[model samples]
Target: MSSLTLGFIPLTDCAALVAAEAKGFFAGEGLDVTLSREASWATIRDKVTVGALDAAHMLAPMALAATAGAGGPVAPMIAPLALAVNGAGVTLSNRLSQALPAGAESLQEIAAGLAAFIGQRRAAGEPPLTFAVVFTYSMHNYALRYWLAEAGVDLDRDVRLVVTPPPRMVEQLRTGQVDGVCVGAPWNTVATRGGLGRVALRTSQFWPGGPDKVLGARAEFADDDRLAPLLRALVRAQAWCDVADNRDELAVLLAQPEYVGAAAEAIRPALGEELIFHREGACVPRLEHAQWFLTQMRRWKQVDGDLDAQALIASVYRPALALEALGTTGLGAPVLGNPAPLFDGTTFDAG
Candidate 1:
């Protein structure tokens, strides 16, 4: 049995992969897996492309971007399983949030005000407002772009997009190097708790049930014999993490210095903390949150050219494997195409 090398970035959502290995899920399947933490998404994609990694904990859109050959090193990546979802938010520096009209009453209102604020800053001769995202192909980047464009602001013109790792987002905002950021959990919680930033909007608000992260591998790897058991192990891990009680233990495991490399205290809050949009209050995590991400991918043209959107999503998500591993045929449903009409008045079909 060849050892499987997996790559991941150090973010809270990488918990499932870390816990699966730590809790013996992978070993149980007679596989030796090495989890390597990469510095950036580009490195992760490159390593996977060249076969340096057997699989990876990848951003949903990053995986799509690789398959689509958009703005990154070309690679044939496929996501046959989802690792986690709905763990991201948009964080604005306290100074910026405070300046918004009505002090963050509603996302649409704040977005409008943010556009106006950027205009005022430009008129005053200040540098264009800069926002940081973990990666260009990440859902965070697309979500930020979506919200800004909705407010009539142009991302390329109204602001500069900078790539900042999740762990550094809080400190970067606190020190005034950037105006705001869109990143995954623990970072968002850390920013708010430290009084440096506030949640302007969660990914959920932008599109409920958006896809966040997925277990990705080279397309050739998915066709290999090793894929089934590997995906089965991941399915079991996902089920274990979904249980409310198991989340705390999973959080502790993810917080280990060898895993996320963050203090346990920092990582724990992000796992169970209800969705808290500093101004909108808290709510439970929902599966619908993952769907929104897929919608954004379509909106951003991340899903390769002229491919059937439904087939593209179905090709990547293996609900059958997830169900088989969990021993529940109906436990999960495949999010291949738009199931129902969207609030934004967009319809996706299997063209």
Candidate 2:
């Protein structure tokens, strides 16, 4: 038997990793897995790069950026499996939320209201409003920027973007450290429940079926014999998490102090229709997702302009590994075709 140590952040989407260890899915595959809860995405990246962690629950963009040496150290990584998708939401502090036009319920309306608010702040010569994201390379950052830009807000000129750990998002809001935050579940729900902030919009509203977190491992470990068994265990755990009947138990399990540590009530909402654990080949690390992330990195000037996009995507996203682990006989089709369109009726042009 081979032993591995995996890491995760305290977010609802970390369910599969928590379930794999709690439900003995890892042990069933003859692997002893330890799930370490890390404080930030940077820590997850650094630890995984140094081999302190064998694998981790990582942001889709962070995996690509790490391999390309965009953010921190250049440690090549691969995402053989995706953990979950579309669980992120934008939350504005109650002070900010109330300043918006009343009864503006729809996402576009809320975004427009925010744009108007930013304009008014600018006219009054107020300081540029600040929005926090879990990480610069995270979907939260990209999605938040896309939403604001769609509403005619200049990301670079009209707002200040900052980074905060997922678990600390609510605290930052409560202390008035930030005006808003784009982060994954449990934190958004926790903030709303605490009455410190209001959820302005879910990422799924604009970018349905968007990529979020993945099962990330160092590139050097790809050839290890234990890789197949680990993938099998994670796939099984993801399937287990997708079942509706298991959500209550899964929520309670994740509510433990060692895991997400949020109340089960706050965590349960994310497990609902908004958060997808495994369905529609969700576990497969689709190439289009990587392409979209690369596009965003280049759009924001985070990646080298001369880098080979196709080569980097192919090297970092390995769906063949997932197919190899699950075998061909019963493995369903991969998510090769384009996903559902965004709220504005546009899809990512990964071509």
Candidate 3:
């Protein structure tokens, strides 16, 4: 088989793809994969659109947005599998964290505090609060919007949302260019550890089983019979990474220069249980997170109207393929159904 080249941003969620290639998971499945570290999500999306990349670790909503041509540079993209879920957080600057009312806990409280902060800042002639997120189509943006809206804060008028890369988020917060940021793991932990910020809310709190990252490929590439095995190899890699026993090893692997490029110590806090949240305390992983991400796509109009979004998401995540590759048919129940209240305010029976 020809070696497949995949693109991924240097983030903890990119680990499965990187590990699949490094640990020979792909080779064991009769595939050779080259993992390329992309500089930005836009670059990764463009490369996949133009076929420069066979596959990539993509933002779930971004993949759907590309397919639907909703925004950004239009391209045909599809995810044949989900990679990770609910590993993102909304981090507030240290000042913001300290200003919350006593016993203010949970996203609702943080949102309330943020509203008050914005008011106080404005009353004192300070500038409006500026916030950052990785991408406009990302769940981080949607989740942040949802959380803020729930608190009766108008996202469009009450605050400013800017596009800042994940790597730069902590620095941006530290420098005070932004008051808060919603981004994936390690960055949030990094900000907290550096005493620059505190996690106001974890993505898991808003949408418990939210989709985080996915294995995306060009539509034509996905349709190609030759590439099916490569997709299968990725599914196997996800399963391998999903095992609790492998978490420690995966954390070490992600710390390598070629992967996340962060210190192992920095990456460790995010890989284990006791997921830190400024509002709610740490919690365990929930299997339904991917479904929550799909719901976010629907909420933000990222999915094409022509497709049944839920079904499309289900098809993309091929647990059966992973099971086949792992030769283990019994690995716990399959993740199914809407994990939280649907963004559309509708409900469906999983059966």
Candidate 4:
């Protein structure tokens, strides 16, 4: 049996990692796995980059950033499997409700309200509204940027974008330090349930079927002989996570002190329908899906012309390896990964 350690942040999407350990999937694969809980995404990325952790539950885009040397230290990483998608929601301060237009049903309406607020603040000479995302290269940041930009809110001038850890998102809202936050799962639920904020938009509303979290590791670690067994264990746990009947039980498991540490009820916000581990073409990491994150990184000026997005995506997303791993376990089918659709009607093809 082999021994290894994995790191994860306290987000519900870490379920795949947690499930593998709790359900003995790793042990079944003849591996001894130790799960370490980290304080932030940076810690997870750094630990994995430095070989302190064998692998990690990582943000899909952050893995791209780490590989491309876009926003942080340059470390070659690979994501063999996507863990979850569309598990994030945007929460706004209650004070924004007063600013919303009557009958604000769709995201467009809510965004219009924010536009008006931005205009009013500009006219009053007040400082721009501040919003926070978990990291610079995160789905949360892009989702929030797209939402605000769609409504003509200048991302730089009309609003200030900051990075805040997911665990502290609700507290930031309660303290009025940030006007809104785009955070994952339980954090958004915690804010709304505790009356600290209101959910203005679910990420799925504008961008469904997008990659959220991924199984991340340095290129060297990802290529190790142990990767096949790790993938086998994680794939089984992912299938377990995809089943609707397992959600209730999984929520309780994730809320353990060693995992997410939030209440089961809080974590439930992202279970079942909103979160995906293996199903919906999530089991295989796709270069096409990775393309979207890199595109966003370029759109935000995080990376420049020197970076080849396609080459970077290929270096980091090993779908062939994932498929081979699944084959070793007799998982039957091979998947190219479902090409994700964009809310803006942009066509996406794996080719």
Residue 349 alpha-carbon offset, candidate 1, angstroms: 12
Deviation in Å, model 2, residue 11 alpha carbon: 0.8
| Candidate scoring better on TM-score of 2 and 3 | 2
Highest TM-score, which number? 2
Clashing residue pairs, candidate 4? none
TM-score against truth, every candidate: 0.84, 0.96, 0.83, 0.95
Shift of residue 127 alpha carbon in model 4, Å: 1.0
Against the true structure, candidate 3 reaches a TM-score of: 0.83
Which of 1 and 4 is ahead in lDDT? Answer: 4
lDDT for each residue of candidate 3 in 16-95, tens digit (9 for 90 to 100): 78767877868876776778988888888888888898888888777767765666665766665566766888998977
Off by over 4 Å in 1: 272-351
Count clashes in each candidate, considering only residues at least 3 apart in sequence or on different chains.
Answer: 12, 0, 1, 0
Using lDDT, rank the candidates from best to worst. 2, 4, 1, 3
Mind giving the per-residue lDDT tens digits that candidate 2 earns over 37-130? 9999999999999999999999989989998999677889999988888899999999999999989998889989999999999999999998
Q: All models: lDDT?
A: 0.71, 0.88, 0.69, 0.84
What is candidate 1's lDDT per residue for 17-128, written digit by digit as tens?
7866888878887888899988888888888889999999888777766776677655767776667656788888988888898755677788889999998987898888
Off by more than 4 A, model 4: 334-340, 348-351
Ranked by TM-score, the better of candidates 1 and 2 is 2
lDDT of 3: 0.69
Clashing pairs in 2: none
Error of 3 at 282 (Å): 19
Evaluated with lDDT, which candidate comes out highest?
A: 2
